[model samples]
Target: MQGIIHLWSLDATEPHELTTETLGQAQILGCGSVLHLLRTLSWVRTKQNRIAESSTKLWLVSRNAVGLERMQAQSPDSSRQDSSTRDSLAIAQAPLWGLGKVIALEHAELWGGMIDNPEVADVLVEIGAAIVSGEKEDQVAYRDGQRYVARLVKSDPLAFDGTSLSTENSYLITGGLGTLGLKVARWMIDQGVRYLVLTGRGVPSIEAQRRLDQLEEAGATIMVANADVSDGARMTRLFQEIEEKMPSLRGVIHAAGVLDKEILTKQDWGRFRRAIAAKVEGSWHLHTLTRAMPLDFFVCFSSTASLLGGLRLGSDAAAFMDTLAHLRHFMGLPGSSIDWTMWADDGMSLPSQEDGKFEDNDWGGSDKLAEYTMAPGIGLRILGTLMRKADTAADAVQVVVLPKDLSYLQGFYGDRIPPPLLSELYRSESVQPSGSSDFMEELEKIPVEKKRDHLATHIQSQLNRVLGFAPSQTMDLQKGFFDLGMDSLMAVEIKNRLQTSLGCKLPTTLAFKYSTPSLLIDYIATQILALESPEGIVTESKRAANEPEEILNKVKRLSEEDLEALIDEKVRF
Candidate 1:
């Protein structure tokens, strides 16, 4: 069954399982569902940039006439490059995946607005029915055999006369509706995102739906996606659905996890398996799914238990989990340093009470159980990293999350690699030197002449701020007032500053070579020149390459100028 359960997903779509019910898509003659349609549809828009390979222009805000005009105007290729742009007349816009939760939604009903070209607008308006339904009939056939139904639910930025994008972005809460999960979801909604997806082990109850209803009325696009994170197949399937259904997925914060703590000598074997499934294997599965995507970011929630490799799960559990976390980091799960997974006490699982005061655990004075378990900031930081690491709206980087700050609740579990391994992280790969040797110190003293050559630049820090220039740009400064025009003065000032700073009055022509600050810095450091020195042996030593055969060979080599010329054939650059 373990093999059979490798993959499974609730979001999996089958032809037989249609939407059957239009939850909120078409309510009360198109007004109620407009916001539902666009705000819940997930997608990512990519625009190739002449400058950056990953740059993309997302159609996130252009629902109003003026906004649409600007979006179209600024587009790199918005001309008649393709008639389909206008020919389509209507587009079935999906939900912007990363949009968090909508804070507001407003509409305009039939109050005619001005269009730059009234004739073109009239033509588009005249064919609206055909564009929405008549043409889409061949594609989006319904149970009743209808075409793409008449639905116009697009969101634009604030101040535009169309649907407004919540001031923030999109957010996904994998364990939405749970104690910690629900709180996190609500927090995101309050942050002004346009959409929120909630996933859990089960369907959200009526109470959860009521909360969502209130949130929706307040202008939030909310959804419920359920799956147990430990289920590898289900998780993989969920990721695929996100690609097809909600392409705008920025990143996932794996807040859904399980825990089992008992003495190693006393805990059952099944306890160990379940814990591994939740803490380690689940992390691996999420890590794998994220790797297959060009994601914004990904973070695995780890416990402080894994950090200390605490004895509760004993040495084996600690070693496995710590190694797993390190592997996760190696796979590019975000951060330059190994992040420690810490937690708050409230999120930890405990026994439910039976009509009585909460029974205290053995070693408790205060309620340290949750502080010992809830992964603090792991969820939020993963979310933050994904949102932050989004290189372009089109390409998102993945990250890992560990709770270090919440260690008061409980300490970590793992074989803490000693500082000895840390010290040798970047050691020499060639020769094995003495244990006490400082190879780095010896390497650093190789002398400037042996260093690599590089581009040099010079910058003049102005007495007055450069006003509009950034720190990396050059600033020209001259003594008193210059008799020359701006361009000439700049060149002269640059030359003098380089001379003063370097203490070597270089050729005026060299000023052109080191015009940039970065170039000037390179000029200062990367200086190289090779000088041929005689190779000789020192002192009385008994070693090979020193015996009579070697000495005689060296003497012969010195006499042979032809041998020297033969060796000079190679150039290293």
Candidate 2:
């Protein structure tokens, strides 16, 4: 009855049969309590790591409702109190759905997913089949009697109808003094939000104070509260004070969250818990405190980590935001969670030169801003549209914008890149070539000595194309591919291209093995010549025919006068 009862290790040398007792308990528990779910997860992971089996493995957890009327209809004997409890339970279980995504990434070979479905039977069958079939996707949703898989798609700019906020209503923005929060406060003031309550845990920096003053000058009342949102009693008192002092709290933007530099492997429970507390616990407190109040909208600012699971330890924050969105929907509240990408301005923007915390060439520095970053103006417009459309949108959760080019992200995600993003990434004009053709005919027309130069140029051009380098930019022939920012995915892509164009079956490690344009050119030229010989044979010896190492060794053994003479002859040629 406790501590992983009836659990069969997945790592067993022989497949273990499910017992009647285990099946009975599984049916009775259904998805089980959160603690039971976590225990199951731990066991499955241990098995997956130990066995390394190819058979499909899955973990299914469901909580979100399909339809309020449909759920009520199906359970006619259930009372209103029962429905309310179920709704709350659904919200509590939402975080696990997010954690499921992390698990899928960590154990991609297992065909894992965390699903949110109303029909438990259908989810179980689908997940079981997926595990057996080795399905690739990780996140799934079952709503309105239909199964939906997550995909990334290009987000068009929101068409603004000039929607404006009321002057009488006050908007509470947690983390208001932070870079993103300050931008939201300014946008709200510009959009006719007359009263603003900006909450953070610290006093404003000198620059932040000046901005607050500017907002006041623009005919807005700004109140800065130094309070921690995770503290329930403190938040309760703060809300009570706001209710008494300001106009009714018409909206709440739960944007307060901390981002740590550590990855999941390096993060202990304390660090992980703190990373999520502001967004997870803080949002929960804000929701409970404001549940009774009639509000226009409650927006949770989330990140793409929940969907993609590559933001180091940011997955914890994503899980809570995802849960909060579900909780709001279950309660029939007007709420939306917007999963955002990196912004060019204000929010998660590159640190300024004055800050001096990061060097210019750092990953989060200005150089990266030019590639696939969203402008703050565009991001704010989209936010406003999402807030306005939250009530009418089909799903309570949405992703506002994604990087137009995913080359940078592809390095980290590889083929596991979400299906939704694949269409957009492939559709981009830069990633696709205008045409393709076999270059065998062209290579045959060239003379032997010049063949190496031709192939080298071809390789360089292809490298430039895949890496998004401009036509005018040139690479050093001797540099390593990784030093040129070529990741594993990109290396594979280049290898595939060479194989197709040259009409030869190249090894998957071609790019990594040769590592430089000059070296790859020599290897290809040698192989082609050997294949074109009278014997018509191709082998490793053919590829190493140039023997640059032997030539270098001979040069090292020669006298200085003889080496200079040989170099002069080669240079002349």
Over 457-481, each residue of candidate 2 has an lDDT whose tens digit, in order, gives 7878877765656533578989766
How many clashes in candidate 2?
Answer: 4
229: Cα error in model 1, Å: 1.8
Query: Candidate 1: TM-score?
Result: 0.34
* lDDT, candidates in the order shown: 0.33, 0.58
Clashes of each: 54, 4
Q: Write the per-residue lDDT of candidate 1 for residues 153-246, one digit (tens) a residue.
A: 2222112122112344344555565555555566566656656666677776776667777778878777667776667778778767665654
Task: After superposing candidate 2 on the true structure, give the runs of residues whose Cα lies further than 4 Å from its correct spot.
Answer: 1-60, 65-89, 106-111, 116-132, 141-148, 151-157, 346-363, 390-399, 404-409, 415-573
Instruction: Give the residue spans of candidate 1 off by over 4 A.
Output: 1-172, 205-218, 311-573
Q: Which ten residues in a row have the lowest lDDT in candidate 2?
A: 6-15
